[model samples]
Structures are given as C-alpha cells and as structure tokens.
Target: MSRSTLRRALRAGALCLTATTAAAVIPAAADAKVGVSTKRLNIQTGSRVTVKGHVDAPGVAKLQVQRRGRWVTLDRDRTNRSGRFVLRKRIRGAMSSRARLRLSTGETRLLGRMNVYRSALASWYGPGLFGNKLGCGGTLQAGSVGVANKSLPCGTKVTFRHNGRVLRVPVIDRGPYVGGREYDLTAATAHKLGFSGHGPIQVTK
Candidate 1:
C-alpha cells in the first residue's frame, strides 16, 4: 500500500477507537427511589423526619412531598459516592404526602407513603353483644373486626393506629350512643392495633 493510504487508514482507526471510548463512558440513568424515615406520622407541629435513598448515578437530587394535590419540591442534596442522600424536614401540619426522589435525569421514583393522622377518642365493645345484628348487616361475632361511628355510613372503612400498631376495618355497627367519643372499636379491631380501654388514637381517612 502507498504511504499516504496507510496514514489515512491509521487516522480512521484512531477515530473509531475514540468514538467507542466516548460511548462506553456515557452516564446511565440514576434509576433511584425515595424513602422516608417513617411510614406513619402523627403530626404535632415541628415534627421532623429524614428522607433518603440511593441511585445508580451519584449526583444531586430533589426531595419532594405531595402537598395540596401537587408535588412540591422541598430540598436538594448531592448523593455520596454510593449514590445515597439524606434530607431532613420538619412537618408543619397533618399531611397525606407521598415521598419521591427526583434525579437530575428528570426521572422521579416513588419511595413510600407518609400517612399523617388526626387524634380521636375511642372505646372498645363486644362483651355480651356478639349475637346481635350489626348495623351493617352481619352478626357481630367475637372475632368480627370493625368499628362503630355515629355519622359514618355503615360499611365505611376507617384506619386506626395505636401503640405503634395499625388496623383497617369497616364500620360494621352503630355506636356507643354516648357523647364525647368519635369511634367505638369492635373488640377485634382494638386488639389488632394493641389498643385497650378508652383513650385517643390516631385516625386517618
């Protein structure tokens, strides 16, 4: 081959190698998820929590909470070498916001639900009432799980939390009929949540 032809072939080979190296070094999507410190929260103003998670690509990411029906950005942080980042925020009031991590690639990954609840007074029932008909139709058995509310329609579902335990049950009956109480928990519902006697418990819609 001629000298000039040989030089041209060498230049083409160098260009192909550079292109391949550049393609191999291109960055990938973070493909990460957002996580919260807690799954359930009883807000008391000034309550704070840590939001954290990792990504495949280590970089800055936006931490956000769903508020007023829209995603609002709360803060931002750069991930460590492991692509992990942690951010802390004080909760202002009751919220049903879900947490998510927004990476620089514009991809958002859902972490978990941070359900906030309101406090309400509750009482348990079931002693001699097992054979009676439930307001929602079925017979109230000893193991039947549900709650009774004055205004909530029969069969309405209610979520209750007590002593770090959570329970979800439907309104299978009517109520305590007495004033100053919001819910009357069936014996089984109360037991599942570790709730006993009469007191305040966390409730969510």
Candidate 2:
C-alpha cells in the first residue's frame, strides 16, 4: 500500500475514536446532574409517605406542595453520604394537592395524586347548619370541606369529583340518612365541584 493512503486511513480511524469518546462523555456529564422521585407515585391522605431521590452532591431537598396554584414548602432535610435522601411525613390537608421534591440544583420531581374515586349520589348541606358543631369535631361552616356517610368510619378519606373539580375530604360527619344519597358534601366542597343541591359525583374509598 502507498504511504499516503496508509496515512489517510490512520487519520480517519483517529477521528472515529475521538467521536466515540465524546459521545460516551456526554451521558456521564448528564448523569452528574441532580435527579429525584417519590417512593410512591400516589399516596392517601393522612398517611405517612416518603420521597426518595439522589442529588448531584450530598445536600438538602425541599419538599413542597402546590396549593391555590402556588408551591409551598412542606418540609426540608439533607441527603445522606450516598447523595440520596428520604423524607418521611404524615401528609394531610387537601389530598388533591400536588407535591414535589425540589433540590438546590433547581431540579424537581412531582408526586402524583393519591386518591381516585368512583361515582356516587352526592348532595351538599350548609346554609342552616353553619355555626353548628360537627358530629366528629369542628363546627359546620360555609367554608367547611367534608362528606357525611352512614356507615363509613369518621375521618375516613373520601375522594370526590364533579364538573372537572376534585376533592378528597374526610368523613367528618354522618348521614344523608335520606335514601338514595350515598354522600353529603359541605358547602365548600359542593361549591368547588360546582354542584347545586344534589347530583351525581365521583367518590373514592
């Protein structure tokens, strides 16, 4: 073979080797960035849940929840030596709220919905009951959010959805002892659902 031809082949081989090395390095660089996720994509209200994930380096992660379209801090903690963190807490308040694990690196991992329910005959009560003490606790008010059922244990979480709106409220009271009605929602819940006096709504166990 000619010397010039041999030299040309050597140059092409060197270029191919350099290209392969660059491609390999790209992924390694990307992996060095922070990433996070929750152990369970969906969680039930009032249940202890954990958000576990890795940071680019050992550091803190801020757990936040979305309420009224704003992100509010739920908790904060640091990662372990392995650059991984697990934040465990009993989640309460609005169950339909969105949540996420956010790192200082500006990376975030969203947690999915916890409760998904079935359809039921739902009715709302409030006007005349306002200022009255609830059967379970707290007073019945226009802004109260909850459901009343005949058999379900008090404080049991029930998911409801109507007219594109969703709510996961506890069984704070009993009844709708009136037949054909499976659940009774408070004024607030009904309003959020765009429900009138009565109608069919979704319910989750």
Q: Which candidate leads in TM-score?
A: 1
Minimum summed lDDT over a 10-residue window in model 2 is located at 27-36
Best candidate, lDDT: 1
The alpha-carbon lDDT assigned to residue 162 of candidate 2 equals 72
lDDT of 1 by residue, 120-180 (tens): 8999999898889988898988899999998888877677778878776888888877788
- The TM-score measured for candidate 2 stands at 0.48
- Indicate the TM-score of model 1: 0.64
Write candidate 2's Cα lDDT for 45-161 as tens digits: 566666677786666887777777899876688888888877776765335556787777676777665443445787889998899988788889888888888888999877776
User: Candidate 1: where are CA atoms >4 Å away?
Assistant: 1-46, 56-84, 95-98, 106-108, 153-156
Candidates in order: C-alpha RMSD to true structure = 5.4, 13.5
Model 1 C-alpha lDDT versus the unseen true structure: 0.76
